[model samples]
Target chain A: MMGLHKKDLNLLLIVMVLALFAPFILNPFPTDSALAQFNAGYPDLMQRFVIFGIFAVGFNILFGLTGYLSFGHAAFLGIGSYSCVWMFKLLSYNVVPGILLSVVMAGIFSVAIGFISLRRSGIYFSILTLAFAQMSFAIAYSVLSNPAFNLTNGETGLQVYASDPQWLQSASAPNAPHLFGLPMRATETLTVGGWDFQFNVGYYMCAIIMILAFYLSIRIFRSPFGLMLRAVKSNQQRMIYTGLNTKPYTLAAFIISGMYAGLAGGLLSAMDPLAGAERMQWTASGEVVLMTILGGAGTLIGPVLGAGFIKYFENIFSKINDNILHQWFSALPDGLEDFLITIVHPFIGKGWHLTLGLMFMMVVIFLPGGLVEGGQRIGAMFKRKPKDTNGGLSAPATPAE
Target chain B: MGILEVKNVNKRFGGLQALGDVNLDIQENTVHAIIGPNGAGKSTLLNCLIGKLEPDTGSVTFDGQPVLGLKPHQINQLGISRVFQTPEIFSDLSVLENVLIPCFAKRDGSFRMNAIGTVGNETDVMSTAEKMLDDVNMLDKKDVLSGALSRGDKRRLEMAMCLVQEPKLLLLDEPTAGMARADTNNTIELLKEIKASRDITMVIIEHDMHVVFSLAQRITVLAQGRPLVEDTPEKIKGHPKVKEAYLGETAA
Candidate 1:
């Protein structure tokens, strides 16, 4: 019975189309253009954008609607990644088992964490989650480090071998694994424009699962369960007196978000075919939080954009160096070039995070709603008269429809 | 059996006895009012009944089942709903969405994990919420943000929210607390109308005598965490103890 608003649906369609064609849009810079330093259209980064987008989207489900700030969501991501790698090592190289294992592991971990953490709310809840995540990280770094060294190859990480069983295909076979016995690889790719997109077989697999995750999140956002979550955020005491159980609702949101994180973790290892304990680090969890906040916490599309934004910056900025900055500024007058180089120097080479941190602070202080809000503002400015009375810059009221 | 029964319920907060040896029985399909001065443990009693505060002793039964120790949502599932003194509807949600939430709870029980179904597409929830809002004369303001509504309209929306749940026993903690006189009268009239149309039991805590006298068939007066008297509205108006504790000696 729940459907997106027509405007929201249109916006979602636009985002989907854009994500699909991001490679082309990002490839606009000439082979040696200065902007090429910022290009993130490559397959590796694009894949990361989607995976982390899943992470942020999941975080938003709990933080945005429920207003519960969790500082330990990275634990679930790390668990997912670890479980996924274990699946690949023990079961098969096929990603399906790995992703499923990740989701299950993350979900079980969340249940235990949520049960204990949900006993407190507000700052306490945040601290509780942080403690749990830190504990997990420490354990993973110590006890699991040895097994992971053997299993995941420790910090060295695990990689698939070419001689490893292609569970999806047998050697000397013309076709990939069949369902039971039927050919499964036939429907893999649908290429266009002479760009050999394999569907990668794996890429399409992740895409289908991402779509499912997106759809599930959308449903939860509109369902009565989501209503209870918002109610819990608004006035928990009132909910209790109104005869509503706030605890279970909060727990459900926590678990759901954890599962999504796990899914993202699984997908990451699947694509890269390795899992390191670093994936479970607190900073990785913080990155998703940043992405969610940067994209707009409550809105569906915000987290995706936030994920893309952060990943894009990471990919592009990491590639730029002092030489690249110098080459661009060399065209200017001597003094101007020196000033320009000074201005841009810190943001290039090893200082990429400095730029990103500054941008994040600006966004938080000025536009807490993230890039989605920024986009909406730009769209509104173009559509309305300059002196429009509505003052469209204010946060869009959540449509009660 | 009474619709709701609380017997010998005792609650203590550290050393302070918030409620001690409290007892009350609310009849079916009647408005029952509890009136007391500030710090008389009126809110504590409400909290104990709804399981927000566990009573150190005694039991609460709704319809024939023990409601003590049950979660709030579990109590709601037993056909009990409450509206807080301050308007508690989701502020960001529209008036309609606020009412629709309780309606969903009534139909779907306490918890639902279905994350794919469209909420607004539920025809029955919309129609029922619409009807409830109409009963409270708030159908016109259904689409407005509940937080933006005037105090009176907000009260109306809260009432509508409770009504949509089809609660057998409605516990309202001062439904007309901060409204202007005109709005107060309107709310009184709305309560009277709802009482007439539905066979719903009510336990209301009120500071305002006019709203209480108009709606409550029975009145319970509390003083210092104990029930001073429980009597018919007429007797309560004349009772010497109630007059001394609440209504004032001159009124008696």
Candidate 2:
């Protein structure tokens, strides 16, 4: 009996159109131009856009709706990646089974972790999740990766070995994870005039999955279950008195989000065909948290935008080296150019994290609703009249619907 | 037996006895008001009925089912809903949403994964929530954020939230506690309207003599955590012990 509301349907349609034409939209710079380096139409970064979008969207379900900020979601992402790789090594090169197995494995992990962590709420809940993730990271980093065990393949990361069974495919089929005979790494570059756009198989696959994830998230946001989650955030004590058991609802959300991380991990390995223990690190968890917070925690489109913003900044800003700075400065007067380069030096190249931290601080301070709120403010400027008088509270949108 | 029965219910915090052998039998379909001074264990007894606290050694039953050891949600499921002194509506949700939550609790039980079903698409839920809001005269503010409403309106929304579940016994811990006189009178009128229409029994813990006189059929006066008298409102109005218990509160 459930269907999308008109507004929700419109949102889904808009996202779909944008994703379908992303190759053209993202490759605005011509191939001959110096700005082409900033063009993000390639397979690797494009795949990352949708994959991390999944990760952020899932994290939003737990943190945004429940107000239970988890600090260890990346453990699920790592477990997902490892599960996908083990599937490749044991089952076949087909991606369908890998994604399914990874989700199941992550669900199993989340059940164990969520069961223990959900015993507490607030900062205590966050700390319990952090402790669990740190433990997962430690085990994956050393104990599981040791030669005696070698479950994670240690510092070298995990990849499909030629010696493995790969029961569904012959050893000669291909080393990379694929969908039937279709290679996930395949891409076609289209050149018109001076513009070059990449149409990637893996990127499209990730885009489809991200779209599905977004749709499901939209449903959850509008569903009675999502209402309960917002209730948990708004007032847990009231909910208990209302006769709603919050623990199971929260655990279900945690598991669903964990599965989303698993799906993202599966997509990542499908494209790159590798898994590393570094994916389980606390910083990785922090990155997804940053994505959700930076986009707008509870909004449906906020997490995707946050993921794209962080990944795009990481890719484009980090590529600006000293040589490139000097070239730009050569056009300016000698002294001023040198001064500008020196000032901008720490925020680019290897210092993208410094830039990221500053942006996060500024966003947290001025635009606490993240990019979505910033977009709303700029949008309200054109409209010139306040849409609703009661948006004065910290809640920017109505639980994202 | 009355709908709610509390027999020799005792609760202690360390050496201080919060309630010592409290006994009360609240009749069905009647407005019962428990009037006492501050620290008379009114809220403590309310907590015991709602499963927020367990009595040290006694039985509290609602409709023949024991309620002392049940969890808060389970007690709620047992058809006992309490409205807090301060308005406890979901601040972040819209007014309609605040009402619809209890509708879900009534229809779907404690927990059900109705995640894929759009709230707008659920016609029965929408109508039930709409009717409840209309009853509270909050239909105009259905789309407004609950936290943005004034204190009086928040109290109305809280009442709507409780009423939507159609609980058998409604425990109100000073429903009109901090309201202005006009708002307090309005709340009394609302209570009278609800009492006339619904098949419900209300146990209101109140300090305001005006509200107690306006709505209560039977009154229980407690002083120092012990019941001083149980009688009709007219009799209790002239009782010496009841006057002394209140005079002490004013003098202190």
Number of the top lDDT candidate: 2
User: Tens digit of lDDT per residue, candidate 1, span A11-70?
Assistant: 556666666656566565554555655666556676787788788889989998899999
Candidate 2: give the clashing pairs: none
**TM-score (0 to 1) for chain B of model 2:** 0.97
After TM-score superposition, the amount by which residue B81's alpha carbon in candidate 1 deviates from its true location, in angstroms, is 1.9
Which digits, one per residue and each the tens of the lDDT, describe model 2 over residues A263-296?
8987788787799988989999999999999999
**What's the C-alpha lDDT at position B150 in model 1?**
72
The TM-score values for the models, in the order shown, are 0.88, 0.97
Kindly give the stretch of ten consecutive residues in candidate 1 chain A with the minimal lDDT sum: A175-184
Where in model 1 is the C-alpha error above 4 Å?
A: A1-5, A147-152, A160-169, A172-205, A385-401, B14-17, B246-252
Q: Report lDDT (Cα) of residue A396, candidate 2.
A: 33
By DockQ, the best candidate is 2
